[model samples]
Target: MEAKTAVNVGQLSRKPELKPKRKIKWKNVLTYAAFVGPALLFFVVIQIIPFLMGIYYSFTSWNGISAAVDWVGLENYKKIFTNDAKFFNSFWFTTRFMFAAVVISNLLGFGLALLLNGALKTRNILRTVFFMPNVIGGLLLGFIWQFIFVKGFASVGKYTDIGIFKLAWLGDEATAFWGIVIVFAWQTAGYMMVIYIAALQGVDQSLVEAARIDGASNWNVLTKIMMPLILPAFTICFFLTISMAFKIFDINISLTNGGPFNSTESVAINIYREAFQYNNFGLGTAKAVLFFVIVAVFTTVQVVMTKKKEVEA
Candidate 1:
């Protein structure tokens, strides 16, 4: 029995010598490669490579058709900056649109979120209804709204004798601008509401209850207690709206097509015209690069400001 016990002890002590737990470095590497390599390869090939080529082409006079690519050395950029009034007009329009879209969408979204955050029995149904518009394609939404603006409003105005609805919504420059804003805000608000709801859900109800118990008004509780807690949601929503409003394209094209004497052309539409419509690839690439830089700066500033608010909160 003693000898058998001694043999068992020896076996236990030499367990680490079996080498069965050895790491297969190649297997681990291959597993990682299997999961991530394809995505990385595609990103490099599709996005990174094209972006680099665009930068290169921006310095050339490539018409995007001929075999001969001529190097122009900042001439395209010079032309954009010096000779192109339409570019600046589009930029200004885009800037104004972005501001309107961001403010209206975020306000409406947050309002809806607040409304639906209660214990109402119809909250679920209302939420689905609100979010349904976001699922519609931008082009389709544009066309639908176009019909409503042109024909439906005319019919409603005719019957009701309302002068407000009788105005040419899409035919006029100012009204066309507002029309896009209305559509963009309507589409974007629901998506933002969902995000705000998520943020609101994560708040500590106990804090809110305690605040209410302290004889605080509903306004005070909401402004002081709830607002700070869910500020990160504001950051995210603002960022998304800002980016989307700045780069608005499909709906802009499908709805107004930058009509009424090019009053509603976004930078994206301008770049598209320069590249595909006009066949000036180099100039278009330059415009795109410039727009990318501007948007990056703007969004970076907004994000930094919002991040500071979050930290302070």
Candidate 2:
């Protein structure tokens, strides 16, 4: 009887030890919730809720001013697909803009990063100057550049008789498109350069030393060692630029206003007009949903491709 009683007590004592682990687990969960709960709550309330509402709104004919919303099934999507030439035109323009903006901005940013990453007396000053444009609001930046293209360029061309500057930047389709690209690249490159600078600074100097000690050539060290390591920066920069370029709005509005025959109309402007200007909220929401899907897919693919490379590295 005594032996049996001791075994039961031994098992009961082991069970108490398990209770501490359960308490520890619960404590960790509560700690995490305490720290992250507010942000998560805000995100759900602000972002997720609105997004869900937007999705619901896409299926109804809810004019901006109307309290009555009529269920329209997929009619809005149908119209967008079968009859909306303007939307597609906007999509095409945005696509081309995205490509040009992403390429030029990234190249300029990466170049500036490389330049300032080296030992230079004025690098800090240059960094601040470069990043200053990005600090300016997009609307303000657009208006400033519009004046530059319209008045400043004209004056410079008048004196210099430069054919390039003499061209009507905002007054024509081709020039208008490139004008936005130039301004966007100029504004964003500096910001991107900062990101790259951080990533470049983060590279392990010890690894570079090891490579050099192993008789690795400078080019090899840069190509094989540095490039692979800083791949994450490229991922981040490309992702940001792609998203920014695709969903462009303020610059388009202040600079071109989709003028010279609506050549520069972005999907964002198109959706805005559909909702507020034209009062076709349903159609606008549908377009927005589609735009969201396209952007999500594009960014997802980019992240996946870049993440694969990161893994390989």
Candidate 3:
């Protein structure tokens, strides 16, 4: 009887341990879900639902505030491509901006990253200063720069010989386009530089040391070893710049208001004007859908092409 009682007590203790372990496992699973569920829910509500609704609205003539939504199929799309000159013009404008912004921003950013990666007493301070522009609101930056372009430049031009201040930076066709590119690159390059700095730090010190011991020149080492290693950063920067340049609106509106005869008007601005200014929500939504498709296709192709290069490198 005593031996049987001892055996039963041991079994009871073992059963309690097993129960707590199982309960802990379930608690951990629930905890993970609790942490992750909010972000997923927000994404579904804000992004996924609106995206689907935009697609649906693109196919209908709702004017954005009507109880009577007429299904128009592809008429809006057909009109955008065939009848609207502004749509094609804005497309070209966006394409040009993307090309200029991507190339200039990436080059400047890489250069800054290389410079800042070296050990110096003031390097950290400089990096903070450089990245500060990116944190400022785009509309505020545009308005500030617009004032500089209009009033401050004129005063500065009279005093200094830089010649940059003498030109109509945001008032002329050619100058306005280049001006926007310059501002965008200036703001975004530091952000990209930070990314590049992260990537540069990840490069293996052993590889660099081996190259130095092999009597490789600095240029040769950087070009052959570092550039190839940082191809992933290049891919990310290019895609970001491309999308940002294409979607630009606040800066364009605040600085030039698509002035100089709408020469600097972007696709986003065009769509906004179509929807709100002209009250053609169906037409505007159609343009937006096309814009989304074009951006998706281009970004997908670019990522595939660049990723292949990264793999090859």
Candidate 4:
């Protein structure tokens, strides 16, 4: 009896312990899916699918409405590289415009932020006034500026007799370029100012007080301390301005309409004319791809450089 009991006990000890498998909680998963499903569906449908179609179209000789899209391989790209003079000219114009607009807008924005950071009675009203232009659509703003450059400036020039104002603002190439720059800066500066103001407000006031007590000059404090602390804001503002300036289209269209012998033509306007006006969808898509590459590269470099400075500061 004792030996049989020991054998049973040994058998029981040798048996493997059973554990329950973890069941996937479908309820929790479904809850998360319910939240993320719509946005993910829209993103895939709207952005990803169109982007893929654009890439495919870039390789074909599709005239946007033809029955058949004939694959041309690298022909379009080859033409863009070797045979497209106007496209390259538009690219050059875009580059120059971007540099001018970015610098001027950021300077004005940062200056305004500094001025308003102080305890001014009218700061709230001034901020509202400055930012009002940004609330208006770019097309409307462009039209408004166009009117101002034409009739309003003509009237002001007539009264003041200023030669600068008297010059045909949108007719002459040089003046037209500067005129666009002025309008772009005016419209965008306020947006940048608001960003800079948020960054300025977050900065430690104690540091400024301590620097003042130490007899640090305003310039020194600004350059050494405040600028470093606000480096992230500069990064954000520069990135915003760079992208906006590079992709400038609506304002460029409504303001100048790429006029004066197409000297003021932007890459976006050029792309539009090529695709819709000229009915060369393949070539336009190719140009658009190149434009995207240039913008991506430039903005990436800018962000990387600024971030490095931010880390150092």
Q: What is the C-alpha RMSD of each candidate to the true structure, in Å?
A: 5.7, 3.6, 6.1, 3.7
Taking the tens digit of each residue's C-alpha lDDT, what string does model 2 give over 216-310? 99889988999899999999999999999999999999899888799999999999999999999989999999999999999999999999999
List ranges where model 4 is wrong by over 4 Å: 1-25
Name the candidate that leads on TM-score: 4
Deviation from native of the Cα of residue 216 in model 2, angstroms = 6.0
Error of 1 at 307 (Å): 0.3
Misplaced by over 4 Å in model 2 are 1-37, 209-220
TM-score of each: 0.91, 0.89, 0.90, 0.92
Q: All models: lDDT?
A: 0.95, 0.94, 0.90, 0.94
* Candidate 3 segments exceeding 4 Å error: 1-26
Tell me the tens digit of each residue's lDDT in model 3 across 245-308.
Answer: 8899988888888878999999999999998898788889889999999999999999999999
Model 2 worst lDDT run, 10 consecutive residues: 15-24
Candidate ranking (TM-score, best to worst): 4, 1, 3, 2
lDDT of 1 at 44: 100
Clash pairs, candidate 4, are none
lDDT of 4 by residue, 161-267 (tens): 99877999999999999988998899999999999999999989899989999999999889988999999999999999999998889899999999889999999
User: Candidate 1, clashing residue pairs?
Assistant: none
